[model samples]
Target: MTRNAAFKVALIGASGLLGRAIAKELAGVAGWTLVRTAHSRRDAQSVKLDIRDAAAIGDFIGRESPDAIVVAAAERRPDVCENDPALARALNVDALRFIANAARDRDAWVLSISTDYVFDGSAPPYSPDDPPSPVNAYGRSKLEGERALLESGAKACVLRLPLLYGPVLDWSESAVTSLTPAIVKSSAPLAPAAVMDAWAIRYPTFTPDVAVVIRQMLGRHARGETISGITQWSGDEPMTKFDIAQRIARVLKVDARLVAQRTPADSTPRPRDCHLDSVRLEALGIGRRTPFDSAIASVLARYPEPTQTLKSQ
Candidate 1:
């Protein structure tokens, strides 16, 4: 089970939401050592390296000599990707290619965090074999990244997850939790109602749960298992932003003036419903779907805001 040898994992985005969660989960797990890396938000525990630089990635991997790698860094914002395709490709596609090739040289397993956006949300529940038709640059770039990693001939597994939320330094940390500040501001007297999208359906998976899943996958690999290929995990509860905001309001105990936009209204085209089938992972017994209500409540408690109402200023 490789218990006699030390297992080192290089976490490539230790400052981001999912990265932080993975770091925490792996911290307490016995027989796993973490070498964390960051780019924009460099920290003491992390070694700062530009993912866009192939040379830097190669050097870092050579020096660290980790047994496995977990990549969480990316240009995740859809709008940012939409506005700048080049930047998106550099970060999402090119950087991943660098890491994959480097890992292949070391014969190290690579688990890359991918998104459900690879599929245009047309089909109800897409399996790993389903065709990908990304609607936006973000999705397209990420899909390309998946290809780059798989094509590198590395011991790689692409774990695709849907919308994510967790404990945040700010409301804007997560698209799901970002609704909080808007809910709070709109709930104040004399403010316009917050408009939330109700057209697109999404499953907001929790990060810590995902972290646990990644750890389980790592353990499987340690015990001499084949883990390469595309795997997906997601929260089962489907809700749009409007549905999510309503739930957030309830959690905050506020009466937010929230308006529902029922039609497709995003400037960037998004899939109507991109529900990823987790049956594969379920069969392997490697996933967790935290109840959204309880999970969101935990997030709010950690980053609680001032209670607002319709009271006059």
Candidate 2:
């Protein structure tokens, strides 16, 4: 709470998973007035915003002139980006440059949310200092966005996150959303009996935990502190997708037969191991993270299980 010193905040993509979590966290906190905006899903309270439109973005920012702007919106699906490289560049690259430039003119610091996919998976446990080697269009576009922000000569922070799965608008909205058997339509997900990337490692971060760090970062800025440059906030536990699937079944009291299927080869080339190392974040005194398994049940409580599973006794 920056008590008695209120500041305006413009949160882009307030309707999405991580965006909604951040909105919820900042709702009643002192010294902050949230101006929510979402594309195609605007409610009565939130302003409708399409980042692709430069005039619209300029208009909104000019009207609000917020103290800080947090960009949680993105075209995140890898396959989707791969299919349409133009759309990917438009949303992930161009829109960010527009935002950064506009925010720079108004002297507002920007906090752009990024991902671990920015790195090539050949390495394990990436740090903030690691150079990005994006193999896919999605990663390439995001890496470009990072460069645009840093080069925009504006006060900006790039928080690169890892594979995210928490409460979602729809079951398929998030990659990790289908990990539970209740929502799975088949006896098992079309995965390999012996998971190919058994050695491939990753850190699955929970959204609310990320929101906590964002809030702290915002609070610090409100108190007149600087948070420039890149930071990594990942799950404490490092595990494979197979490991995650097994844990989801265990915690939800469902069958773990899904882990037995052969891993399906992805059409798009994925980084083999992009585990984000969070020692820098810890050293900087960021938020404490909940272990992946520990956070599973709580996230599960939000979404209703499928009425029935396809598998029969």
Candidate 3:
């Protein structure tokens, strides 16, 4: 299908951090009819369709018969998924499986969003072909979600992502953004002291960059090209969470002190470092990777300055 064919596309989770970026990226682009859906936070502009509801998804797919479906919805928090495995599976795995099956039946394609947490974080810089050994419930559920979608025998692509940050309605929308307030809350605009896992490594991804990558992949798919199976995409630099926090403080011009603290001896077992090697996407010539600092600057530039600084805890 050419771009001029006016390809019908369904984008789930259009109100989310990444989803919102993707929606904006695709906006005003010719030859795409976007059908957006959300669960409870439905805006007047979006359709209310719970991904967990299989029958509703099936009905929606049948009615819309979109040429492609992009799944950006999931129960993404690790702690939340760890506490409620079933809900994670329902949202992360079952919903994707349902979409895959329905799209297959209609000869449509799927682009399912996945996470880098599929790895156990023991290894450094995982490749696209690496065997996934997720340590947490969220990772396991998402890995299964990937399996379900790819094994459904549909023309699908699973883009494994890293920790994402971007412009959002609030800082709580992304962990990276949530750390910003901690820095600027001091009376003297000093960066607040925030504890970070010194040993854990992460490659932060900007949502706008991810959106561009997805749009490129979708464009390829629309042009009857093969951009299927699993691929890794992330920012260029690899840094620890503490490093990320410090970078945030630097970019925001806050003198926040980011403490490099190791994970507690008795704390929950989380992946130490799941740095994804994004060579697959690079080889395919399909990503707009921005340097971490520049990306942070661009994202923070969008929002207003911080409000009255609150007393640090």
Candidate 4:
């Protein structure tokens, strides 16, 4: 299909952290129209297209005829996916396939946002070439989605983002938001998980940076390239849950002394070290990774008040 000068872009999950940031970035660009998705038609300019419904998606594509499509909707809760694998697959894997096929049919470029959970945590600093060995249901479902996109032969880019933090546009509370208050309260005596053995490192890119990268990729000429979006952090950098907590506490001016460190065996099954190397992204002229301390400060700057303490065991 011929490329259009004025690109019409469709973002599937425009309300989420990454999606919203991307939408904001795309909003400022000339010759780019962002069509955000909603669950219903009450919202103007939003097509009520559920990714799970292939027919609806196909129809939406034909109607909107966007030049680029970005799929960011997914059941991100790992434990919830484990409880119901079918639903997870439908949203994460099958839906992605439907979108990929639809994008291919319209000759539009597709970008799917993914996670670092695809790794089994056995290795540190995972490269894009590393074979995924997911240990949990969420990771498995995401892997399936990635495979479907590749197999469909669509012009696609799968970006594996590490932990992300940004300003809260909506007051919607999530696990990350819920834990921030507690971290702030205990900043004075910061005690975080001291799982030196349980190592999982990530660049933790800011949401705005991720959005800029996506915009660059979509506007660029490359197709069928998968890149990892992470910073250059080492697994042996003495990182742990405690280290992160301590940093957050420091940034937010919480009582670091109150922070306690512990390692419970029943914690979530995560990779010991899955820091992604963004050598490919750097080469592509995308901005460098955000500094870890700067990222933590940004998070704290958003939530200055600690109304309640995070329940610590």
- Cα lDDT computed for each candidate against the true fold: 0.90, 0.80, 0.83, 0.68
In candidate 1, residue 241 scores what lDDT? 99
CA shift of 161, model 3, Å: 0.4
Query: Worst lDDT window (10 residues) for model 2?
Result: 304-313
Model 3, runs deviating above 4 Å: 1-4, 186-192, 264-267, 302-313
TM agreement with the true structure for every prediction: 0.95, 0.89, 0.91, 0.82
Candidate 2 lDDT at 250 equals 69
Q: Is candidate 3 or candidate 4 better by lDDT?
A: 3
Model 1, span 1-313: residue lDDT tens: 3656788899999888889889889988787789999887776778999999999999999999888899999999999999999999999999999999999998899999999999888777999999999999999999999999999999999999999998776678799988888898898999999999999999999999999999999989888885889999999999999999999999888899999999998788888899999988899888887899999998888445521111210
Candidate 4 residue lDDT tens string, 1-313: 3344566889997766677678788898887788988553214545677888999999988888887888878888778888899999999999999998988898777788877888887775688888889988889998898888878877777888666656554323333344555555443344452222223443445777788778877767333343422222121233555566666667766554443334334345766657776667677776545666775566556565432222310
Judged by TM-score relative to the true structure, which candidate is superior, 1 or 3? 1
Residue-wise C-alpha lDDT for candidate 3, range 1-313, written one tens digit per residue: 5545588889999888888889889876787889888776667768899898889999999999988889999999988998899999999999999999899998888999999899998877899898999988989999999999999988898999999987767677787877777656641544456666677777889998999998888888888885888998888688876787788778777677667877643144578778888887888788987888987887777444522111210
RMSD of each: 4.5, 4.8, 4.1, 5.6
Q: What is the lDDT of candidate 1?
A: 0.90
Scored against the true structure, residue 137 in model 4 reaches a CA lDDT of 89
The runs of at least 3 residues in candidate 4 whose Cα sits more than 4 Å from the true structure, single-residue gaps closed, are: 1-4, 40-45, 169-177, 185-199, 222-239, 257-267, 302-313
